[model samples]
Target: MLTCDHPFPLDQYDDRVKEHLRFTGFYHASQIGIVQCQKALVNALVERWHPNTHTFHLPIGECAVTLEDMAMILGLPTDGLPVTGITMSNFETLEAECLHQFEIAPRKSNYRGSGIKLTWLRDLKERLQLTDENNIQSIGQYSWGSACLAHLYRALCRASRFDCKEIDDPLTLLLVWAWIRLPYLAPVPREPRSFPLANM
Candidate 1:
């Protein structure tokens, strides 16, 4: 139930990405902290996913997404090493990100934001067993609706059988979508990336 029929926005980064981190109850980074924490996050995630590398396509605005470009965009270090489509923890955790910035009053009479695509995320949040006692929607609005894609990718990873120390397969992208697209914890930009999802 971790993922179903959705894709994680592995490449997207919101300008207020820290707000998403806050959703996971991780809002202690300042300007430097923002950059530092993101770098740390990327390093930790990349290390875990290094074993699974995929030759996937990544398109940036008006250009192809190189590792350096990704580093610049996401505040990651340019180690010259390629990146996995995903990394880090799944959406379910003790972490709780507050939703004041998103104008989400989970405790209010009614919550906000709606769209046909968003229905999947709302469902995914329920599947993850998150609550809304403290204006906590778990998933925020930074990301339009990429969880459904991640869900689908997770299914693919589960179905694929690959052995390591043999053929190098970038199957982590398929495997770690849920972990990477964690609602607010894994917030993407409110505005869609200029790159097309189909390009990937």
Candidate 2:
């Protein structure tokens, strides 16, 4: 799994953002390429989501517009968006909101070390299957997990610039969560471990 100790640097140039999104996990999965899907997603966002301000930096890197701002920009009603009680105060709240939306069970009390497993991947794929295939295919020929992760990473990356104030639709947020969180749980290695001769 990719280990990013810090949040992505949204203050950087567009090229830098593109590089991080595309090449960071380029070869991690065979189902689809990260770079290709990112471009497609960007295109969709550009076409569908209008920025509140006339300046690109204002909308893209400084602060995210709230759901109200989004509605104003898109000329849509805000009544349809669900208001999440969790705020972006910290990672825990963000994670909790995501877990709740995906219906991922909490960690067992008896759990010992790292809880990563194949079951997470299975559950993620199942959720993706419930989404529209056209939406899924727009990104790439990615598995449910890969597509979900890409979307989440992009959303968070976009959210980072906006002081974590963006209000997206609950369904949209759920989809992004599935993409971002699912890929982090890498498939468990199947090969057996070898023991040292000294142990025998």
Candidate 3:
């Protein structure tokens, strides 16, 4: 399974930045601790995934993660502008966006095709300041929950392919959703679920 290990240091931010995060619907998501993925369970679930229907084919019935699950599990906004944009664009545009969003210019070495390394993102989180208040706050206008669900669906579709050997994406959301809905397949939560269900 492919995993993403970039953890945000939310506590390092000041109250102002923290408030911005809450305002942008990311505070609860940022609170989620590292989840212990059960690879066997995940593999089993993937085997049941139906890319055509975007649902799991279980003996009981078909079920799938929805926008509501994204909101409940990750505290991301479910309603707003869709998270759609030009992904593969000119390097100059990409550089401009990076500078606008994180206020740091990335070197060409940071490029991975059209995107920069996750390390750059992690570095920005460590040093991000709300210098451009409106610009940063504008991100709160997008439906991040929808974006997450879309990404998960796309990842599932690709991973379910016959020759696909590994799954890549944030598996935490999927695992948590499964844990909540399919208890028999879940690990016992280390503690009670907090505000965002992923915090369990």
Candidate 4:
């Protein structure tokens, strides 16, 4: 099975934690942020029909907090960390190393014929379209960039084949490229009166 490792340092500034929560689509609750993010991400992956059998190798300490602690924090089942091995924190450049490994990982068997069946991209596109129609302004370049990358990663992960070559179909390639380049485009601002303001 194709495995991708993402090692994030939770020890970084508080902003990093918030950013991680935002990127992973989980509420930034300190007590359960890590586990909530993990569950949200995993659930999203499953919703995309990614076979539940795939492996996720999460490293504790440097890359992230311990899964046991995460579970306790989230009040979830403790299965001794979902996957087999956790990455070590001793590695000096953990993120770079994990990304390098991800670049070469083989494709999962269950995802052989399917090419990018990610709903997140569709959802993002709808949100972007709504933003354009309503003239809603995005938070910043970083937020947009992160969203674009998330869409791209979802596309790449789902489209990947056993040979690791994304499907060469023109439409799929075009869509993926569009998502990747979304950050470069001008922001679409949300129009005034798009929604009724609540009374303070």
Candidate 5:
């Protein structure tokens, strides 16, 4: 299975930076500490997943992760419009957008097709003044919850195919939801439950 191994950087940031992340709707997500991906459980769920219907076909009944789960488990805002946008297919368009939003135009080499390198993004994030009201406002307007849930759905759909071997989605959110809803399949949470259930 594909692993989500990134660290939580919110703890490392100063209060000012944390406030900026909060304003941009990433504060709760950033607060989630990394948890081991439950591979066996995830794989079993994948096998039961019906991409056509977007639900798990368990013996009990059909169920799917709802937007409410995203809001409660991940603390994502689910009331906004669906996250949708046109692709920036060319380097020039991508560069211009980056310059406009991030105020730093990465070199063409830093981009692979339409996506920029994570390393480059990390570097830019460090260099940019996140406290700047303009930058915070630019990012805060999007429906981050919808964007996250959409990507997770897309990843689950792709991984449900017989030809696919690995999942590249937010497994933490999925696992937490499963644990809360299906206690029999869950390990005892080492910590007490918290606001974002995933943090427990």
Candidate 6:
């Protein structure tokens, strides 16, 4: 049983947490319903996911803020980062497609298309059962899960460079990334309208 309710500081770093989530099919790539973006998972992924190019901080013209800065703003863990974002190129992204799919099931829905559920995420313990995928599919509501999707989205951000306006706070910029990626659960340049954040 996990005890840390706050899920900050490093609770998510606990291997048990990752195992729990993964077993619950959190890492399962076929399930296609909405899952809860547990703070534990988000904090863990932010801490675990590789960094974007620029040494540590994201480049904004001449200024830059680092993962540590973003962690500080969000009150998350900032130590022991391992990011390949700086060199995350199209080739690497292409290479990782199969691995990514095996690790995470990309939502098969289009931007504002179908297969979105908004019902309350059931008990993680219950969902952990490895039976069928996308149990939330039957719920008919939109899935509000974001942590897994966010990790994938962040990967796309790293693999490609998008023209972003000057944003002062790294926290706000991170949130903007989340807002942009979360809505459609996608991060790509398939079309300008597909991603509104492109203009913002």
TM-score of each: 0.18, 0.21, 0.84, 0.21, 0.84, 0.23
Please report, in order, the local distance difference test score of every candidate based on alpha carbons: 0.30, 0.33, 0.80, 0.30, 0.79, 0.32
User: Which of 4 and 5 is the better model by lDDT?
Assistant: 5
lDDT of 6 by residue, 37-63 (tens): 333323432443344542222232222
- Clashing residue pairs in all predictions, respectively, total 17, 6, 0, 10, 0, 15
Q: Per-residue alpha-carbon lDDT of model 4 for 39-157, expressed as tens digits?
A: 23333222333323222223321121232322222322233222223544433344344346433222232122333223433333333322231222222212322232334344445
The lowest-lDDT stretch of 10 consecutive residues in candidate 2 is 1-10
Q: Which candidate is the best by lDDT?
A: 3
Which residue runs of candidate 5 sit more than 4 Å off their true CA positions? 1-11, 89-93, 107-114
Q: What are the RMSD figures for all models against the true structure?
A: 16.3, 18.9, 2.6, 21.3, 2.6, 17.4
User: Which residue pairs collide, candidate 3?
Assistant: none
lDDT of 5 by residue, 5-94 (tens): 344444488888788778878788888877677888888788788988889999999999988899888887776546687888889998
lDDT of 3 by residue, 118-141 (tens): 777777766655677787688899
- Give the Å shift of residue 84 in candidate 2: 1.9
* Position 1, candidate 2: lDDT: 13
lDDT of 3: 0.80
Q: Rank the candidates by TM-score, best first.
A: 3, 5, 6, 4, 2, 1
User: lDDT score of model 2?
Assistant: 0.33
Q: Cα miss at 60, model 5 (Å)? A: 1.1
